[model samples]
Target chain A: MAEPLFDRLALIGIGLIGSSLAQVARREGLVREIAISTRSEKTLERARELGLGDVYTLDPAEAVADADLVVLCIPVGACEATMQTIADSLKPGAILTDVGSVKMSVIDQIAPHVPDTVHFIPGHPIAGTEHSGPDAGFPDLFQNRWCILTPDKSTSRDAIDRLTAFWRGCGSDVDTMEPGRHDLVLAITSHLPQLISYNIVGTADDLETVTKSEVIKYSAGGFRDFTRLAASDPTMWRDVCLHNKDAILEMLARFSEDLSAMQRAIRWGDAGALFDLFSRTRSIRKSIIEAGQETPAPDFGRPHKKGRD
Target chain B: MAEPLFDRLALIGIGLIGSSLAQVARREGLVREIAISTRSEKTLERARELGLGDVYTLDPAEAVADADLVVLCIPVGACEATMQTIADSLKPGAILTDVGSVKMSVIDQIAPHVPDTVHFIPGHPIAGTEHSGPDAGFPDLFQNRWCILTPDKSTSRDAIDRLTAFWRGCGSDVDTMEPGRHDLVLAITSHLPQLISYNIVGTADDLETVTKSEVIKYSAGGFRDFTRLAASDPTMWRDVCLHNKDAILEMLARFSEDLSAMQRAIRWGDAGALFDLFSRTRSIRKSIIEAGQETPAPDFGRPHKKGRD
Candidate 1:
């Protein structure tokens, strides 16, 4: 309807985020031709079955050939290797970008391998669920969500504009950020939260006192909230932790220190201190809701079949 | 319709769980008379406005007098004080119970203060939201959820049967467990999950690099799940933390150890280890669904307005 945003676009990994992007892009006519690629042959075959893209391949280079835009959607650890494999095949004036959780390491790893002729804009769409693989994705995943871009100082302005337009066409609100700042923000907002969830779920699994059946049966009370997060794609998250080590370790240290103080207060039976801290955090949830960042639910991990809010 | 289960039932608090119990109990016509008591005058007034109980009182002793059942619904830290105030007023052979998160501490606190004439059966309902106060409750809160009872060895068999019958009247599936085992099970299922949520949110709040706005705005990705648990009533959670210190601390230590191992794997870029753990957990979610412990959702916190799941 609006003269499709790109003539041809390539998506290098067709997992949850990638598939969702493909769906939304198709729905909005963001690209005329979509080229999908993944290292796994099975996944590539599945993508073909789903008719996710016009061209599907196991070769990263062939996927990017003649593409006006290329988005790397693989785990962070595979970024550099994939970049090396596709560098020679990328269209000279095409824009190359990635949907990585951490931006600093991505820029560090893939920027040097890319040709100076192609535009390399690192990005992350702040959207996903615990479910992975192609089938888990949906068309509206990026709607009303933020898509952060971290372009280097030497980057071409035209490329940044095109990338921003592409994201906007995909139903995302795009924002530009510095690479270092982007990594730091995601470490707190995404990476740190994921690590804590994984850690706690692991703790519950190993406890001799609590049988696994009991934990699962009574999870509705509070624990089920963490399970969704702990259920996240571990490979992607593992790569995120390794790539964003310093910020994550820093946040973890701060978390441990705060937890110790809470433990001490609880041990001493200082109800006032514990209550005060807990009460203060209430404002943050309020802020999130007011900002339309979350929906208020009466229960966690359960769908409300009757009420609509 | 079946006859009312009790002539008179007294509730000692009117927070989320208590008020929900009152609403459901009334809607189901489970009791002929409902007497409500809370230490806070304003909360009592609010409960009265909601018509949650037939009789309202600021005094626990007065509320429990001549009642067939007395349920202590206050915070864990207040159990001993409430037990002291109501012990002498309990009708002979009346079923006395509490809805405490940690069972062992509640038993230790209230048992000594209660008279031998009353049958004390402690319970912990495995259902709730992060919300609190009388207004935060709804009628169907306990439906399809587990309600665990921890009866002492000295407790009468008839008392256990009656209490089980009463919970069923309120639409809960009742299960019997020892006090110590209940505490340990809940520590992993409820306490540790909450602690991790609070700690991670605190970690996000204290970050220097990640602006608070960024965290709030992008929370829909995964961080929003933790906020629901973190948003729970501060006083109630504080008491739970203080009362269940030993089990919580032990679980925390195990969590930290598991986190270190995960960190190591991430540093080594071990995708195999990550995939193995991630893949194994998906089955647990499937098990929970098969067990009818969870509902599949289109969005985690949103009420499903659409017909599709």
Candidate 2:
């Protein structure tokens, strides 16, 4: 329908983000060819079975060979080694990017090996479900979501524009920011929330007074919401925690301090303080809904069947 | 046709739970007449506009008079005052119940005022959305959800049975628990999660490094889930915090301790520990989904529109 942005595109891992990129790029004709690679034979075979790419391999080097665009979709922990493996094979003037959640550490890991000929732009698409793996992806995963790019001043504007256009082709709006700022913003927005979710679910699991069955039965109250985030890919989250340690730890400290204040209010029966904080937070949800980043429906519009008689 | 469970159902507040109760009870013919009361004349007027009750008043005593079922749907903090006003006006042999989130505190506040002729059974329907007010309710709010009844030994068996049947008629499965046990169970399942949510949102709001707009824009990354819980009614949550102080404080202590351990794990790059906890928490979500307390759909089935080209 239109000219493809790149002659060949290489995906370095066939996980949720990689598979989603494959489907969306192919459906939109954003690339002429797709090359998929992963360390696991089963995953590579599964990608082949799904017809996710035109060529597949277990070697990151072979996948990057002759590719004009390469995207690392693996966990952040694996980026350094994979970049060392694929660096020499990347086509001159090729665009090298990634879908890691933490940008500063990912840039720190991959930027060194990048050849002067290749543009190394780190990115993160601020969207996903709790599900993971190749089968968990869909072509529309990036639809109406923000795809942020953190490119240095030395990077080519033409390369940044091309990558931005490609993401737009895949149905995402693009924003550019400094890598350090991206890390700080996402610390509060993503990393801290995920850690809190995991921590709360773990706390509920370890309770001596409450049975696990009771927690499960009555989870519809609020715990279930935290569970969805806690159900996310463990490896991905672990890597995020390791890679974004400073910002995450800082946010966690702040959250804990605020929580202690809330605890004091609860213990002292400071109804005014509790009400003020609760009232202030309601406007934030309203802002998110108005910003088109969240659904306006109640309960995220989960289907509610008529109650049993 | 089935006979009505009560000749009159008096609801002593008309917020989300109260209005939903009114609509569901009338739709299922569980009550012959409905009387609604709220301290705020505005809320009472709104209830009348929504036809949430057959009769509406600003006085609790007037609403409970001649009613076979009197439900205190107000905040737990107001229960003592409302019960005092309506205690003498209660009909003999009538059931006096409440829908407060905290069971033990509510029982403590209302039990001393109840006459020997009246049955005092406290309940909490484990259902709601991030919305409040009379207009933010629907007849299906309690459909397929659990309504826990916390009644002492002195409560009549026949009264408990009628209340259980009435909840079933309103489309909720009913479970009986001791008030103390209900408080402890809900502390983990509901209260702690809510407080954590509020605390995190407040943390994000108070950040000096990250802008509020940035927090709102990137909320889908994980922060938005907490915002829904944080957006719950301020007055109701404040009362819950104040009334359920001991259990909530204990749960909060457990969560904070767990969080500190997680923080240590992250700071030290303990990938194995992080992965283990994350993996363990995923199964809990699966159990919740299997138990029918959560929707099986990914992202709670929020709509994902096609990306902009």
- What is the DockQ for all candidates, taken in turn? 0.49, 0.73
- Per-residue error at A67 for model 1, in Å? 1.4
Candidate 1 lDDT at B58 equals 97
**Poorly placed runs, candidate 1 (over 4 Å):** A304-309, B263-282, B298-309
In order, what lDDT does every prediction score?
Answer: 0.82, 0.91
Candidate 2 iRMSD, 1 decimal = 1.8
Stretches off by above 4 angstroms in model 2 are: A307-309, B307-309
Error of 1 at B73 (Å): 1.3
**lDDT tens digits, residue span A82-146, model 2:** 99999999899999999999998898889899998999999999989899889988998898889
Place model 2 in a CAPRI quality band: medium
Interface RMSD of each: 3.4, 1.8
Tens-digit lDDT track of model 1 for B185-231: 88888887887777778767877767888889878767777887888
Worst 10 residues of 2 chain A by lDDT: A300-309
Q: What is candidate 1's lDDT per residue for A1-309, written digit by digit as tens?
A: 788878899999999988988988898898999999998999999888888899988999999999989999999989989999999999999999999998989988998888878989999999887778888778877777789999888899988998899888776789999988887777778877777777676667666767778888988777766777777777788688778888777777787788778777767778788787777777788788777666655564354222221
